[model samples]
Target: MNPDDFSRVRSLWTHCGLPSRPNGRDSEQHIRRELSDNTASFLVAVDPDETLIGTVFATHDGRKGWINRLAVDPRWRRRGVAQALVAVAEAELRRNGIEIIGCLIEDGNDASEQLFVTLGYSRHDDIHYFTKRDRPDI
Candidate 1:
C-alpha cells in the first residue's frame, strides 16, 4: 500500500476492529514514512470489486522479519483472508532476505494466536515483550 491508499487502508482497519490512532503512527504522514523504508511492505488485499478487504504490514530490522497490523474485514474472516495476507507478507519478507519471521499477538486474542500457531509459528512463553513509547498512542 502506498500513501494514496491511506484512506482505504484506514477504513479497512477500522472495519476490522483495529486501532486508528490518527495522532500517532497511524496517520498518513507516518504511513508514508513507513512506506519509504526499504525493508517494509504494506500490503492490501482487494476483491473483484476493487474494495480492500485485508491488510498486513511487514518489515525487518536488518535481521528478523516482523509482521504487524494484520487485519481483515470482519465479514471476510474465516475465509482465509488473514492467512493469505500473512503468506504474502512472509514471502515479501523472504524476498528481502529475511530468515527469521515473527509476529506479536496481544494477550487474549485467541484467534490471532491460534492462526499464527496453525501457520507453524511457535509460541515462546519464556520471552517478555517490553516497549518504551514516547506516547501511549504511538
Candidate 2:
C-alpha cells in the first residue's frame, strides 16, 4: 500500500467505523516503504476504475509465515475479494519457502477465524499463544 492508496482505504475504514489510518506520517511512510521493498508483500483490491477497496499484508521469515493485515471494504464484502487476497498472499508466501501460514486475529473475530479455518488452518490445540504486550492489566 502506498500513500496514494489511503484515500480508498480510508473510505472503507471510516465507513466501517474502524480506525484505518496509520497512527502517524512516519508510521505510514514506514509501512509503504516496507511494502515497496517486499520486506512484506501488500496486496490491494481495486475496482475496474482502479479505486482501492481492500488490502492484505503478509511477511515471511523464510520459515514461518505471518499475515498481519487483512481488511475488506464494506462496499466490496461478500464478493470474494478477501478470499482472493488470501489465496494470492498464501501462494506468494509459500513460494518464499515458508510452510506454516498463520494470522493473529482477535479471539472475537469469528469471521476471520472462520476464514482461516475454511482455508485449511486449524487452531492449534497443542500449543498456546501468549502475548507480552496484550495482557489485560497492561
lDDT of 1 by residue, 37-95 (tens): 88899999998898888899998998999988999888788999899999999999999
Give TM per candidate.
0.93, 0.78
lDDT of each: 0.89, 0.73
- Backbone clashes in model 2, listed as residue pairs: none
- Give the per-residue lDDT digits (tens) of candidate 2, residues 1-138: 666775666566566554343554224566667766654787788889887777887788777888766888777887888899999988889888878888876658888888888888888767778756532332
- Alpha carbon lDDT at 4, candidate 1: 83
Name the candidate that leads on lDDT: 1
Best by TM-score: 1
- Compared with the true structure, the alpha-carbon lDDT of candidate 2 equals 0.73
Model 2 segments more than 4 A misplaced: 17-21, 24-26, 131-138
